[model samples]
Target: MSNNRQPDWDPRSPAVFDDQIAAYDRMRGRCPVARSDYLHWSVFRHADVLRVLEDHGTFSNVVSRHPSVPNGMDPPEHTAYRALIEPYFAPERVRAFQPVCRGVAADLVGQLPAGGGVELMGGFARDFALRIQCAFMGWPAELHEPLRQWTHRNQEATLSGDRAATAAVALEFDGFVRGLLDARRKAGNAAPDDVTTRLLRERIGDRPLRDEEIVSIVRNWTVGELGTIAASVGILAHYLAAHPDLQRRIREDPSLLPAAIDEILRIHAPLIANRRMTTRAVEIGGRRLEAGARISLIWASANRDEAVFGDPDEFRLDRDSAHNLLYGAGIHVCPGAELARLELRVVMEELLARTRAFALMPDKPPVRATYPAGGFTSLALWVERCS
Candidate 1:
């Protein structure tokens, strides 16, 4: 109800969206925990955000009325869905997916233009994410175009803040997943053994998961797996292009890619923020929030908080990993974190191995994505594809 108050900041302003990282950095220093009519309460500090995360009892994840599988659930209810989904990203499963992931990466990097300026985001990064997601889920290539279009609609609806539009796009996605489920069911014994099929037989207590639950889980993964991976690919490539020395070093010794990837993503987070609601009155960062308060945990800011990372721009591998909220912390920490790591590492390794060098196109600067998204939407890079 207090959303009627004066706004602290316009999150969708050109100043913030044009360069999200810089704008967020300023917000962190000026007001670590801010009240915005747009975001309700935006928590910018690392410690403050971590506090909300660790204490889920005080900060609920059910910020929206729409159900979001385990992502929007807490404790007892969340516990069951979380346990059910985590095994999907277990070590064995991730290891098994490595070769498939590598093939997708190599194919994408292989498509880069020869020593010419190419728009990295649409040309390579997004394609890589789309291909990898389909491969990981055992979906057909025909679904790629539809998923791409759906992702765009989802992002637009989310940023527009139109609940009706958001719900409409969500139903469109459910239809896509339901179609896949129906095919697998009709195929019966001939169904291709993949994640979707596996999910069909999964049980919550004594009952098989309903179609709605299955669709919700798949939607959450698509939101997590597809968009973030695409953003991360662009961020990683842009960072490497900007810093040739580090890129050269990574190419020389690919062993450093994992740590380097984490550090780079720490510098520029792919996922902007996550939502939470105050279940009880709590004071955070000199501001008291009443119960039912809507909160936005700005990962884009927290990961780069100067207090934790000491000179957020400096790239160093020696820093403590525990403090990096790149994948977040606490009970609701990303269950698919291992899968993300495996995918990124495989992609980077293949990219470095395939390319001699890549540099930003001086003439065409990168175009930053607006709110509800992170990283560049268009990145022109002069890619020197290796022989």
Candidate 2:
């Protein structure tokens, strides 16, 4: 192992995001595990990423859990919160949201004309995600535009990694959630049940959750879902447009769409990496990470690890590698992962069913998001709008 420590891998590198198929391959060879001041120590290999996620005692998720939700908690306490929250995102709940998700996608698709094209990122991706999030959480429709604006600003601030900006966004998100919580409380049990209602009534340890904790949990789910789902949708759309045969296959047999979604998520995980702190000294990929140190587990790199995912560079929709770390692994695995899958499945299904073809504008540069998020910044597709 090299004695030199370098800044954790930078996603801003064009070579990594733009030329990803090649970038991760070379990095795994030269530096499977690199250290960065910004992301702390990063683990690129699949085994290492799995180890960190599974061993919560040694590698703490609590470091980032201040915004609450079980994501920031380790086992025991984490397990309890997950038990309360998981059922809300279970298969039945996800199934319930499918129609609503498809309606949202159909509405967006209807807005595009047969001969015209639109920037899929802002028009379709963001709007679809926002609508589904608000519907699932049962928030008022009036807050949609402001909530969308806040979501965008919050993502920008977090990716910029400015402490003040991140703090500001957090406060803004909390305030918005607090207002909603107050309204729900005033409505009392007479109001229909929704995620907010369940959260307010559920107990974590002894009594019902404190208002701040409720705000934190809701904030985590809302903010985290918005950007990631939007980016993932954009990525899948970009790929399907680039590869027509695969698109046709998915369209002909909707069964293939779900598998295709998993493969796409594995290939282009929306987030570049997530941070975790070490609670105790631990050896990962032969390097000893000391306690109090932060580590960035590069999910994109890990998903493409040659050792685990054969032909890691190619996009094979039928690969049996269902264990990809896209939603992550172990305890802090995404709480809304099933919901995300449902959203992707419904959107892809509707898009393919409605349209037979799409055209990517030539020579127009596709903007790439750096670090925190993945996928194209502005993916404008000349979609063949259906009747």
Candidate 3:
């Protein structure tokens, strides 16, 4: 890597932000592995992205100088933390949490105006994510608005690429989690037996987890649940609104909801990209890159790569599920995959069951979210309630 070599692309260009998916599709075609001043090297094609994922030794997940728990660590360390976190989303745990999840979904769906227009993002999607996250973590309702604001600030900081602002946001989140831990510690024997309290008791390497480690672990779960879950809700709703036929099919057979949700998300990803740093000199997509180069696995593009998915946008449940990188792949695959799937499926099922039909409002077009975020910013749809 040298300052002399010009940037292959500008990730922040106005054109790219205007419609990220379309731009990434073009990039996958034109420059599968491209470099930018902001992101260094971006691997867009499915095959190339898979290559990076499978060989974690070469493309390391520890991209940030700041700590990111298991996400920012390499093997052995990543393995231990990952093992500790996985049980929280285990099948039985996820199943036990279903009633609470469904209640949250049902309550939000009930709030939708009967047979009327609603802005899905604000009125439904974000609310569902916030409520479900708080309920899962045993957080109070009072924290929702603050957490919502924090999520917005975090996203803004990430998109701005301002390290100071990002750090400030991280500190703000840490304060919130630290307060929860402090209260639980003071309560001691009387503390609510919940996920947050349980984290305080977790042991790593024959010692109780440190406050910072607990904060990082909780922060990771919060970010994944709040951001991706919210984005997925909006994306799924908007997709269904635009495709009435698929909507009807899913409604007719609720069992199809799970596969439908996965297929739709694969077509239009909720997560944009994930970062990896090159551990050593490597060649990808016919490009030479030196060790220590930063890399972005562009999920927004890779999942829809025509090389693997044929038409890319074609909706087909029969497609091989393994090829879909909705929750990613390799060692860093999303630990909360099962939890996410359950949340998406339950919410969509409740929504479809409650509404007769939902379609895009002819007068109000949905706005696409910018980079570091995916899905709609605001989606207006007309709902026809079941009579």
TM-score of each prediction: 0.97, 0.94, 0.97
Cα RMSD (angstroms) for every candidate in the order listed: 1.8, 2.0, 1.6
lDDT of 1 by residue, 1-387 (tens): 233356778888888877889999999998888888788899999999999999999999987777889899999999999999999998999999998998888888888886888998888888888889899899999999999999888988987899999989999999999999999999998999999999999999999999999999999998778889999999999999999999998898888888898999999989999999999888889888999999999999999998888899999977788898989899899998988999999988988888888899889999988877888889999988887
Pull out the clashing pairs in model 3: none
- Highest lDDT: give the candidate number: 3
> How many residue pairs in model 1 have overlapping backbones?
0
Error of 3 at 302 (Å): 0.9
Error of 2 at 119 (Å): 0.4
* Pairs clashing within candidate 1: none
Local accuracy by lDDT, each model:
0.90, 0.80, 0.91
Q: List pairs with backbone clashes in candidate 2.
A: 6-35, 7-36, 8-35, 8-36
Q: Select the stronger candidate by lDDT from 1 and 2.
A: 1
Ten-residue region with minimum lDDT total, candidate 3: 1-10
Instruction: List residue ranges in candidate 1 displaced over 4 A.
Output: 1-4
